[model samples]
Target: MKNKGSRRRPNKAAAPRKGEAASDGAGGDRLSKLPDDILLNILERVDTLDALRTCILSKRMLKLPTMLSRFDIDVGNLARHHDAASYGYTLNHVIQYNNAVAGVAEKILSARNLEIPIRKLRLRFYVGRDGCLSISKAFACTMATQRVDNAEFVLLTEKSCLKCTHDNLLYYAQQFNNCLGDYPAAFAGLTHLWLRNMRFGELDIPNVLSTCKRLVSLRLSNCDAGVRSVLHIEHAQLVELCIEEGKFEAVQLNGLPKLQHVNFVGWCCPDPLTFRSVPQLRKLRLEQIGISSTKNLQLSQFLANVPWISDLHLDFRSEKIWVLPESPKLLAPVLGKLQIVNLDNLPEGCDMAWTMFILEAAPSLRELCITVWDDWCKIVTDKEFRRKNGYCEKANVEWQPSDFDLKHKNLVKLTIHGFQPDVIFVRYVRRILEVAVNMGDISLHDRKVCERCMDLDPEIKVCPSRYPRTTEEKDMLKVEITKELGMASHAVIHFRS
Candidate 1:
């Protein structure tokens, strides 16, 4: 054996050394050979802190920030170590983190060819007693010159301006002044802006708007200050706008020739006299808001005047109707061209009347939902009044099934709620279900027919003598019993009657 192979137990160390060399030939060597541009692209995809860590690898990676087209600085990450109760004292960690970001940003700013003009910038900071102003001032200064094509500013805090002093306003003004003072003329080409949980007064709104002449979209959420004041948006290039839960008077579109979508919340109501100015407006949503309750103020009337809007959503939750006679007739012709209508939380009395009116008016109305109370007396009384005047009698009218055609042939879904599942209701459900079974092409249907009739009469349960059933009848001896009741269902599948 020694003569053939010279293997006196071939050295194990040599084999292990060969395997180590093979492993080194793959990943480690390949990664090291990748071009700097490719490595910078990889680092750019990670968060800022992770991006910074790439610098630790080698001096060649230090210039990675110049390749970043986007920058998102989250200040909340800095303040995580401070307990709320101990927040009155200065947090050293917050200061350190701020300093670190400032240094990185400075590097980004100073890079000549490496500082690619940012296409987007997002800053999230909590406005608070300790460190918000300085951070905002710093961020604003950077933004004022960054030539960002899009920017988002989010300031969150539980502190209310209503509780703060004049000094607080002065401090805010100083920060705002810093941000707005030399706002680079470069931002005039920016296209989008989003602000959340940040308050701005009348002066601030105009000042910010002036910076973005080419802005196509703007969104504000949960910000308050001069909320009741109307806005005059004068951008010719704007197309979409959304404002929610902020106090603002009326919204006036100044000169947005390309504008199409508008969404609003809080207390702004469109002025009926000035709505048609935006000729291209097509879609609008109004939610969780108040409209004038004066007898002369009518939503339908106001909406009718605007011919450009094709889609509308109105939510009047817990709101009292200001206009009297709650006629669907007034709303129908106006909404004839509408593709969708959502009426939520209308009062029981108003709901019934509105339903009838809508069914009559909008022959083109596509969907309807109505919720009524569980009171039997109210239903009976209302039905009696409607029937005496030649409205469909409660018993004669066929309940609309999910497939049933409505005044509008296109209606697809109808949901009703808050009805007492009593004897009368069960019979109503039975009638509706019977009608539904006869309809063709059933799809996505839910018919919750009552399983039992409950006696909702309060006085009937108090005395045994007042019980309607006799002992013999209860035992099948047959005693006579009687009660009268009343009516309605969805807007779908056409019925011959």
Candidate 2:
């Protein structure tokens, strides 16, 4: 018997166990009690090494690393602990980081339970002698022993593209070729690969595509065979391809039966791309800064082979317009299937009527997005730099509306970024209303803010922005638009600040 006012200290043997304590809502390791599937899902989002370190803290989780089916071990993750104050890590720091990544990857791969299949494996490592060899060997062994479904490798050089010389790029490319020779099994098993700051031989890239038989995606950044070298790609399984800042004069898609997506950026050649056989291509994106010598892209002739494209994105990079406006008669055949179009970074003061060519051609177009702004910070403002780089001066694109009657019944939504309360914008909106007869919604948004743009020299003449601010101004503008158009527009106009 126990007194009601006194503490009952008699039933020590009836105390709850740790598991019972957790169930009773007392303090306990609730995370460890979670199911393995839930725990694995939580760990999969983090770096593989960090996940393994977390697992080592609990006895129940100590064996969980071996059961993991995915790994993303990147040397870039180690930069969080580094104290460097530069744009990139130092050479010694990068070397040490690569070694750490290699050690962690090897440990996990070597200790993994072979019964559990690996679904994905991604590794980003520096291209050093010892580190590359160790990493290549570990990945090769994993590919040979495990049932890996997808593998990706992002090889990095010690120096960035801006810091690397021609000799450095050549050296990196040779090292990569050697690595490919040494570890053919790993390359063969890869489904995705990214290489940067490398200048390969004339036939090196073609040979690489031939070796990577199962590759589905390939990205080359700041890498080229040589200046003005023609790159001909013909792959059986490739579905997506991206080339950024490469110096290839022409990239001929000789044959890619399964390819569906292509993205090309920072191209300077007159005619940078040619399509021969890409029957399944559906999405294409091109971004470039227009220069004096760069010829305007003619989509009518350029996309004749791939007419089934449904999604198209063209970024002018706030320079001279690089796309030539063609008649709808010539463009309709190539653009018949186009449904979505994003014309990004058109110069601020250009005549927007030229854009109507797209609306006239793509009869099935349902949504159109246009961004008009001159981002001075991204544009080279220095006269000498612009001259040296062959950048063209900012000027209005000369174009007039064709005499053909325009009527698009499919367009339902129109979005304009960097909308201003000026004649150019108002006129553009009126033209859109006249052409897009079935348009239901028109959204006008203010320009995107850029903190870097504030630091530019005051002398640089940025386009004066006159965005509607007060409610009265907005209502007045709406009234003025309706009054000038002389008809009731069925589209709901929204002015977004």
lDDT of each prediction vs. the true structure? 0.49, 0.87
Instruction: Supply the TM-score for candidate 1.
Output: 0.55
Summarize candidate 2's per-residue lDDT along 5-83 as a digit string, tens digits: 9975697566676556543345667777899999999888888878987898799999899989989998877666565
User: Which candidate number would show the highest lDDT if scored against the true structure?
Assistant: 2
TM-score of each predicted structure versus truth: 0.55, 0.90
Question: What RMSD value applies to candidate 2?
Answer: 4.0
Worst 10 residues of 1 by lDDT: 477-486
All models, RMSD in angstroms: 13.0, 4.0
Off by over 4 Å in 1: 1-68, 81-102, 106-119, 126-149, 156-174, 184-190, 194-204, 220-230, 245-249, 268-276, 289-297, 317-337, 342-406, 413-497
Winning candidate number (TM-score): 2
